[model samples]
Target: MIQGDSVTETHQGILKLRVSSLIALLFVAAAASAGCSEKMGSAFAPSAVEGVVGGGQLQFHDADTTSTATQGIASGGKKARWDALPESEKAARKARMAQRKARWDALPESEKAARKARMAQRKSRWDALSESEKATKRAARKQRKARWDALSESEKAAKRAERKTRVRIAK
Candidate 1:
């Protein structure tokens, strides 16, 4: 089961444990029933667990070193990865993954997709305008700004008063 390099400080930060040590420890404990799940991921032999850490009880934990076999490529996609696997298992796993991805994609987005409806509405306004109509509208907008700027001082004060009365600022 120990398929890679020995555990070191950097690897420890990454959650790798020695499976060979675990297997050795299990053997020393006479736990023949303690079968190593070729997949359960360990580097220490079962017997090695009792080697001398603290000179007492054995230490065991979930190992995290990913094996070379977990390359994410579906080897023989239609075939079972494990001989014991049922025929339907592969299809079912694929179906589940597809569903998971769909759900993830469907999830509301914080920065993008969630506001799609709002964005589409805004885009629709832009999309509906003809090129010449848009140019005319831009000219009209500029004229409106210029007209507002040309207002007399009294006209500006009146407009500001009207705006103040119409707009209720929330606390």
Candidate 2:
């Protein structure tokens, strides 16, 4: 009975080891791909500039980018779906990314550092906007609403009537 139990235990341990190795390989693949994405974008990289920006530089204002990174405006912005590409296309995408990276590298170090710092500060300020500031804005909004609500009934009626007339004329 002891020998039978020992044999089963060894078999299960080997099976566990194989599963762990497979999982480890998957993780390694994921990590390698993540690194590639920063440097090369995906196999379907639509914009070369984005791939370059995804790394350390943070490109936003370049003429060809999908959007102003700060304003969150993009020309082709299908933010949900990223991957799904053919291999030949992936090679082409990688070439495009290299070009973008080369252009970015040509800038003077001082300029590069300055731009990086400026963008960092901008991000910091955007992030650091306080709850107190938010509350103040809220209070201001409420004050405006309250003032609007305080209008005399006759004034409100006149505005509503004017709006209705304008709508009718526009239509």
Candidate 1, 16-64: lDDT as tens digits: 3355445445555563365544344444323223343224443333354
List per-prediction Cα lDDT, in the order shown.
Answer: 0.57, 0.57
Please, what are the lDDT tens digits per residue for candidate 2 over residues 1-89?
Answer: 24643557677787876775565456445545555342364332222222221221122223344432211232234332234566677
| Deviating ranges (above 4 Å) for candidate 2 | 1-83, 130-171
The lDDT of model 1 is 0.57
TM-scores of all candidate predictions against the true structure: 0.26, 0.28
By summed lDDT, which 10 consecutive residues of candidate 1 come out lowest? 65-74
